[model samples]
Target: MNVDSPVFLFDQGIPGFENLRQFIFLEIEGNIPMRLMKSLEDQHISLLVVSPFFIYPEYEWELSEPVKQELLIKTEADVEVWSIVTLPAEPSQATLNLLAPLVLNRNEKVGKQLILHDSTYSSRAPLIRA
Candidate 1:
């Protein structure tokens, strides 16, 4: 997992994470295996992540051309994605942060957290990110 000093956190350590300047990109350990992406801000910690196959089982992004270009991802193999989990006051109220998601281009080790302007989405949208 240390490809050219891979910046991924799953199989790597977050050296100097307390002072890390790159807030946009990261490496995280999803519920399953270690994926890629971590939160430097308050949105999330513990590096929550999800496999596209599990969470977004029915996801088909209508991403704009600009976003696709920004990710520098010309193909499906380059995409890596994740969402945040919200600990509920009680088990019945559990939720996930689906309004904003972290999308990354593993090929380049670059990432970005985007807020879905779509009002249909819930800030505490389920991890289903559906």
Candidate 2:
């Protein structure tokens, strides 16, 4: 792990990979707006994520009180949201998982993948910037 990198703790880890806890957000070296969420415990566990608001300008979701308290989130500014990207053989065919967004508390350096039960958005939404 890079000493300079800020480690984000996921108390419950990701949905399927619940055992892995610690993660670090790495910026991709290029013009692409994507970020690499690398797991500290597993070298093979890295996810490509991007800000959902960049793709869907009007994208919005409500965080439950439990989630806010879990991450120690106090205000809207303390939160950051990211969507996992699924890239197919063709880059243009990539999709973003909007149904379950990764919500992070910037101040606390903790995060959780939140599943929106009442969301009309799809799990595989077209990755087109609006």
Candidate 3:
């Protein structure tokens, strides 16, 4: 991770967490693929996030033109995707919200949680393989 990683601005903020608009992605110590998305506005509002592709190799989606324009994404290389993970009381039950992925434009440092209108992905897809 870059020491000067830009703070991502979610203009409308994440759904259900509308109050949080700015966040920085922090790599969790000892967790290679997990990251802590810490909200700048609310210190306590941190989320565990990961690139869904790490667990689901086939994970893929086409960003709508509106989304691309909103994030100022000029090319495919400018996009980075991640999913919020829910850590259950039982660690093994941890799941990733694949239905609504966090799409960020690395170039603009802006992001949005895109909820698919219709998809096969689940909001609670298991983190680990069965």
Candidate 4:
């Protein structure tokens, strides 16, 4: 994941964050599996993200044809999936938004937050099993 100079350009931006189109992915220090997705347009708009597979080993999804074409994703290796993390006052109550995921094309440095409209997944799935 050599994303040193990578700038994720979201053509339509993430939902609720339409004003932000450019972002930088930065790994959170001391947290190997966590990352800081900071919007270049607004420093305050930073999202805590993590590879969903890290918490949910069975996490998987197919990118829609339109998404594949828009992101220019040709191979599976070109894509990296991440989920937004919600940290509650009680860390044990933290959750991950599984219904919507952030998919990035490592090859093209573009990304999007795709909402799974017909999926069984939940928006506030537990981040870890009890």
Candidate 5:
């Protein structure tokens, strides 16, 4: 199984998170709810992720043109989206930012993290209780 996959960012010549071109998504089991995102290039940088729907329901996402072209996403039918969250100092206080999401075209294992330009979202939106 692919345990540690490299995630990329758009930068230089990359269209979607080309700067963060490679990352590994690690899942921590035997725990209530915990996950780790370890960066392959810079091991020190990692973001905690969780199901955003837990807090925000009916979240909608849209991809950018450059990202679609860079990732080569053929159609809206080809993508799965996820959001990154901050592991708050306190587990209960942790929040998930649904406005911004990390998109993945699972067919090719290509993914990118993007922040929506509109200010209609919050970085620390709380995930609804499950």
Candidate 6:
């Protein structure tokens, strides 16, 4: 990949798409908070992910030891967090998978989808707040 298209390596890949490991983020224009995470291994697989902080500033979670080591994350600055977004028929009905946030080690270009078992957050949290 070129400098403009740096790819993220998901060591174990995302949960359902385990076989596809490499991905690149395609930014969406026009003040959008979402991004298109396109798989390098498969052209057909693409996921819409959003920074949870943008939608919920209070959103927070701790990474397990295994996850931390796997990503080689050293500090908060070393990582970027994103949540999978699910768009429905209606724009307002879009939801984000808050229960499982995708964390990427920026310095290492490594990523992993982490499922929070102790959290109260839902897998499908509403995108638009009332």
Q: Judging by TM-score against the true structure, name the best candidate.
A: 3
Query: Model 1 over residues 45-75: C-alpha lDDT tens digits?
Result: 4454554446556654566678779778798
Give Cα-based local distance difference scores for all models.
0.54, 0.91, 0.91, 0.89, 0.63, 0.90
Off by over 4 Å in 1: 1-5, 8-45, 89-92, 127-130
Clashes of each: 1, 0, 0, 0, 18, 0
- Give the worst 10-residue stretch by lDDT in candidate 4: 1-10
Provide the lDDT at 29 for model 3: 82
**Residue pairs that clash (backbone atoms under 3 angstroms), model 4:** none
lDDT of 6 by residue, 29-51 (tens): 88988889999889899899999
Locate the minimum summed-lDDT window of 10 residues in model 5: 8-17
- TM-score versus the correct structure, for each prediction: 0.60, 0.93, 0.94, 0.93, 0.70, 0.93
TM-score of 1: 0.60
Judge candidate 3 at residue 89 and give its lDDT.
97
State the lDDT of candidate 4 residue by residue for 37-109, as single tens digits. 9888887898999889988898877789999999999999999999999999999999999999999999899
Candidate 2 lDDT tens digits, 1-130: 4657889999999998999999998988888778899999999999999988887989987899988999999999999999999999999889999999999998899999989997899999999653
> Any idea how many clashes model 5 has?
18
Error (Å) of candidate 3 at residue 27 is: 1.1
Q: How many backbone clashes does candidate 4 have?
A: 0
- Candidate 5, TM-score vs. the true structure? 0.70
Total colliding residue pairs, candidate 3: 0
